[model samples]
Target: MMMTGSALTDEAAEAETLVHSTKTDKPRRIAILSYRSTPHVGGQGIYLDYLSRALVERGHDVDIISGPPYPEVDERVKVIEIPSLDLYAQPHNGHFALRPRHFKRGEDLYEYFAHLTGKFAEPLTFGERLKRYFAEQKPQYDVIIDNQTLTPGLLSDALQKTPIIGIIHHPITQDRQLALDAEKSFRKRLLIRRWYGFIAPQIKVACQMPIHITSSGAIKKDIMREFGLKSEQLRVIPLGVAQEDFHPRDDVKREPLQIITTASADVPLKGLIYLLRAVAKLRDDLPDLKLKVIGKLREGATSKELEALSISDMVSFESGLTREELARAFCAASIAVTPSLYEGFGLPCAEAMSCGTPVLTTDGGALPEVVGDAGLVVPKADPEALATALRTFFKQSDELKAELGRRAFERAQLTFNWSRIAPVYETVIEEAIAR
Candidate 1:
């Protein structure tokens, strides 16, 4: 069938009109700077990966000017690789070669040695690199979204004129204080404090920057308390999940009674010790209960607590999975737990609920703030309360658990989906740019 000449002309006119219409509003140009984006590592990388993708999906031209182990972003989004001393390597799987990649110069070698001596060097070097990026590219992005690098490098003497908005996921000072509380010897405490000294600049920059965004009100308060910023100085935007991707699977066989937690080990702020003890206390009643951990467990007081409670046999560790795998695990488990002593925002709590699994979280930091009245909440650092919550869920019939899970799913759908979050981010970016 052949189209008429008028139909073809009409199509051409519509195409031209659409093109001209789009040309009127300049597509937002964004520059996101991150020190590292190692897939298996920290929350900074995940924040960079998702937020940039969301921006690009909404017709924004985004660029991630990142250091080593670049983020997994949409191929359409430009990723400008900016190299620096990538010390504190996270033992890349199946390849533990100690060979250096970029430490050719004396300065690079010195930086690597500095990291070996428990000093953090990436944020400092990455800051220097940001200056060069602006000097050469000279790309005037609408706004520079710094992914909590908090390095003075972004605010360097040369680049001070450039408008940059700092994103502090949570105050690193909080992490430092928790580490001090968890330390054994005075030397360990000193070394831990020294390592966190990198955060001092972050606190300074977050305070000085004209605009600041954090993940939660809890974190906003912490940042203000730690850095002494005014209420108006901080903007609290909650983190979100991809609702379509996180729904539960009804067919996946439940493991008698299984519980899931992400990044559960190593970080004292996560409060894994209390969870382990809770599990230990319940092992007699719910003998089939299992813990599926989705992060590398650091051998600290948390691990020692597990040993002391003799709950090590019931715990299983899994790490380095893509977001899809994480969602599947969320479905495969019965309940999701976030035992953090503090969270900027409890992302896993929302993510699991989005997957249609009810969450049991601590009333620490932002967990209760994010979880609201939907999921079970208990006091921080209390094994007895955690055990009671776990016991209630275990004894409840599937019909009840399913009902609570449905409410959780609705809460996540209405509140914390990425579609809901990205527009708020856009508003913040525009506000900063206008200034």
Candidate 2:
């Protein structure tokens, strides 16, 4: 039988796609670097775990080279431990961790003094350890990717000979500015500047890299502007979601007038204070309104704000929840909220959407990019706006809420799942190796 012209064209396109997919599916040895990778502490751990797992699933050999508080990754991916002083893990903050033994080594002395002076020296210290480790181990990798370390050691000629990419989630400059703006004391402001002194080295390292990966375009632009790099230097590969681990639980009953959010840190950047105030404002009219924050409400400005607002009784906080437990928290809530002042890729927002929860998020950084049209968007740090959005959401009937959840889940399947995102990463890795 003679094939029609359209049928021939379709066959040709299918063949081209198959060829491209097969080329990308070819395995390569990959090394992922992370200074610290504790999931609840920050997104670095999550990124390393998910990306390594996704890449390995695509038939790549993946290993994580990390410092203290190492990442918990998939069984197939190996984790190479590079120990630091683990200063943060010590009592009295990092002060008590310092000892006469630290004085014996130049790098240890630098780390100890820097921490005592309120400067974050982990990245540099970790880099020194990484350099020494590489010198001794001499492991081979086709491409190496650093997760937000941006250390001087990455620029070492030994490692630079390999195809290396740096992942800058977002500019720490933004975080520094937000912290400065939040603090009123000059001494504390000075300390904030001191803590972020690593940004200078980070910028230097980022600018020298051959290629970089940022989670969102918003972050890519920020990196270019902050690190003095051109747009071509950066690749925008949005983060992935573990959809299987965070799917809808229809058997879990949703709580009435209850809201859930994940704010791992009680910082100004998280915008939890605004959400607290909004909850305070809405609780009178909706007396049953309750909030469950998936983070510790430590004694700090946020806790003090809760006391001032007198809404402490209306709010509850939890931490260290497993992924399945977190999904259940999302399922049981009437809606999920992420009121961040800024985000690199808004992984929590994507997680909520994957769980088929209707989300109400602030248009901060890449959050709007993550939520898109599936969830409600409010301006960041505006209690009035947040409260209004909450009120509007609560006013909706159960059918509308379920419909929103369905849309969120559908959107997650189309855009946020790892099955689609992992290949983009492979393409970038291949390009770096070829270059």
Candidate 3:
């Protein structure tokens, strides 16, 4: 039974797909918990989207139990939406404030009052809702993955029996500290502290979890230091990028002197201020250079910095872009940069790399780990260093830039592909289930 060449090729392709797939020998029921999943914003939502898709591809039944701004996932992945006050989306005036119906539930009352007093209570309220939902639904699962919502409700008696894997995406304490460091007024700092009060419960819950996961060793250390977790309880699994959505667009021509980056919030951790400073310094060197920020320009320190630097005209921002649109933006840029002061996994850096765009990121948190030797790295929070690196990068010949882009794409494919990373996660899940 000798097969023709095309038939043999088809057989080989089938074998390759099987080998590369994350399919498991025994399929299990899995539930992923996320408090807030803002779609495409590249935090909890992006994590849920890719993980659930990969798990379903691997022959697992996955249910994403999430709060408002529910994640967009594969058709095979069931999404169980848990409603929240979502106060941030609502007006805080007394007229639109608490209603008689809100008083029906203590959680709702607390959420309304907490937000009224300038405290961020979504995490706590979300946890309450999650616990109630679990009790009512009584959904059975082989394992549960908590996506950084280290709320005390997760430890309720109903869920205590199941094997729950908690993932701390870089301790929220880092976010708290960064916010505190960015503000000078004592009153503002106090408010920031109050806003981050959930950290206390998060730390408490994290210590009780049997197993925890983080995206990088850098973040694992931070979690260990911040949450008082031992090394044995933690596993480092690198996050995955959507290869199909983020790959290079050969049809799009890269524009010289055009730089692109993703900085959703104008926070100190994002280090956008430093990038703005670097861009200001490079204005004379590269007169026509343009910076494309994939985020909104809100009224904050970043806006002030842009005005102070007088480079607001040269800088433009775009938000709410589709995955394909973002990929095209990455492909059209000369290079992508992530100047974050710290990142748990540096997903944007990986996304840019997947688009075949050479990256220039800081040695912040896991940015160096994500970049590896594929692109360039500069000292975090150093605008002069960024300027120097950009100068050097711009000096490289077109051939060199193309080679760098190729290396970045290759590294992303090898290191951050979901098909490869999902199996690692599956092993962790299976281990927890066995325990």
Best TM-score goes to which candidate? 2
Using TM-score as the yardstick, the better of models 2 and 3 is 2
What's the TM for model 2? 0.94
* Candidate 3, lDDT over the whole model: 0.84
Clashes of each: 2, 0, 0
> Which ten residues in a row are the worst by lDDT in model 2?
1-10
Model 3 lDDT tens row, 1-435: 111011112221222243344545999999999878876555668878888998898889999988887888889988899987777777644326677888889999998888777787877888899889889889999999998888888889878768999988898888899889889999999999988888898899989888987777677778889889998888777788989899988799999999998988778999999999999999999999999999999999899999999999889999999889989999999999898998987788899999999999887777777777788888889999888888888989999999999999998898788887888788788789889
Ranking by lDDT: 3, 2, 1
Model 1 Cα lDDT, one tens digit per residue, 141-232 = 77788888888877665566657888877777778888899788999888897777688777777778888887666667677888888877
Instruction: State the lDDT at 180 in candidate 1.
Output: 91
Tens digits of per-residue lDDT for model 2 on 1-435? 111011112221222232234347568999999989878797778888889998899899999999879888899999999988888898888787877887877789899889999999999999998888888888999999999899999988668778998888899888998999999999999999999999999998888887887776666777778779887787776677898888988699999888998888878999999999999999878998999999998999888999999998899999999989998999899999988999987888788889899988887777766766687888888989889888988988999999988878888787776777777777778889999
TM-score winner between candidates 1 and 2: 2
For residue 43, model 3's alpha carbon misses the true position, in angstroms, by: 2.1
Candidate lDDT (C-alpha), each:
0.75, 0.84, 0.84
Cα error, residue 419 of model 1, in Å, equals 1.5
* For model 3, the run of ten residues with the poorest summed lDDT: 1-10
**How well does each candidate superpose onto the true structure, as a TM-score?**
0.88, 0.94, 0.93
Better of 1 and 2 by lDDT: 2
- Give residue 142's lDDT in candidate 3 (0 to 100): 94
